[model samples]
Target: MKRSLGTQLRHLIELLDGAVGAAYEEAGLTYRPRYTPVMRALMQNEPATIGHIATAAGITQPAATQTIALMVKQGLVTTEAGVPDGRQKLIRLSPQGRELLPKLQQCWQATAAAAASLEAECALSSTIEAAIEALAARPYGERIRAARAVMVDSGKS
Candidate 1:
């Protein structure tokens, strides 16, 4: 019996996420699934405000704040007062975070290479990215609010 379209898509997502996670783990990196998206955003745009980071990463403000706190405690990020707005905090990679940046790049590169090596690889890459872009095009705050609503309503949070 064939799987439903939604089931197939979900399985592909899980496989892609798992493969990347396993690759990073095998490389001895201590990256969390939640942190990967945030780290990628930070790597692309350093010295951004926490609000901007949260928006870019498509997570709630509190979620971004918590992630930032964890990263700061782990010595991966540093925070300072925003230049123009003293009320807002600016975030950037710490020295240690900067040092780990190259390793992060290498890990992703390895993952990409592995994906390319797989059979039917081009279609796999296209499907994954198109799905990601579709999700990314949605309003981040709305998505988070909806997800929170569902979790709360279902009492499975």
Candidate 2:
């Protein structure tokens, strides 16, 4: 039996995230890998809107919002209503978060080195990038719907 592509992708994430989580734990840092993109975005710019963070992090706005909420609860970030637009929220790193930045940046550097080592051993990064580009042109949902039509037409569904 062979694993499905989705299963393989998920397993890969689990393996990588688990190891990274362990590294953070050993470093005595309380952090989540999901927070990395948000942190990076905020580090680059303060008083950022959710949309800005989303674009900077290459993540959806909902994900950025959720991560920001969690970070706020952990006292890692502060959010306030935008001065120009009361409805829009601006986010910035809290003092605690800034204090942790140096250590987090070091961990990120180490993680990148480890990831590069893995990339040297495998074509993982390039393949994922290509897949992302291909999917951007024709999304997976569209592909699935086309395949489903074929299955229905052939009475294979």
Candidate 3:
């Protein structure tokens, strides 16, 4: 009856995202946490391909593509043909998106401050960072397989 680690992590992320989304709505900003990576990628390097954005945002290509489609629909970004390869499309912030940057940055700062306050109390940020680094060094799947092998050898199922 207990939830898995993945499920618990997802629930925590959803709760945090909901709180941040509510704050954005209250501030009259239409921003969402999901859009942050895309915005940041474009802000840092405009006319970037979806692959480039994905790498810069630390997300998968499919996720970056989906986010780009949504951003395009929202008029927050525009796409143009890549210069070197006309078949490739490059993404950039729209004029509207550019205009919203200042407010977005302010909201980002406030959100960061709120997260910092929570981090100070709970050390959640550092803990999560350490966990990520540990996992990167040795993935959970590797650990799980090794444990399973040991369990089977001991007839523990």
Stretches of candidate 2 off by over 4 Å are none
Candidate 3 per-residue lDDT over residues 1-157, each given as its tens digit: 9999899999999998999899889889887778999999999998899999999999999999999999899899999999776888999999989988998888889989999999889999888999999999999999999999998999964
Model 1, range 37-128, lDDT digits (tens) per residue? 67888988988888899999989999999999999888889999977768999899989888877888898788767777873556766776
* Candidate 2 C-alpha RMSD relative to the actual structure: 1.5
lDDT of 2 at 94: 97
- The TM-score-based order of candidates, best leading, equals 2, 3, 1
The best candidate by TM-score is 2
Clashing pairs in 2: none
Task: Go through the candidates in order and give the C-alpha RMSD of each one to the true structure.
Answer: 7.9, 1.5, 1.9
Every model's TM-score: 0.62, 0.96, 0.90
- Which regions of candidate 1 are displaced past 4 Å? 1-10, 55-63, 128-157
> How many clashes does each candidate structure show, in the order listed?
0, 0, 0
What is candidate 2's local distance difference test score?
Answer: 0.94
Query: For residues 1-157, what per-residue lDDT tens digits would candidate 2 score against the true structure?
Result: 9999999999999999999988888889999999999999998988799999999999999999999999999999999999776899999999999999998988999999999999999978999999999999999999999999998999963
How accurate locally, in lDDT, is each candidate?
Answer: 0.83, 0.94, 0.92
* Prediction 2 TM-score vs. true: 0.96
Model 3: which ten-residue window has the lowest total lDDT?
Answer: 24-33
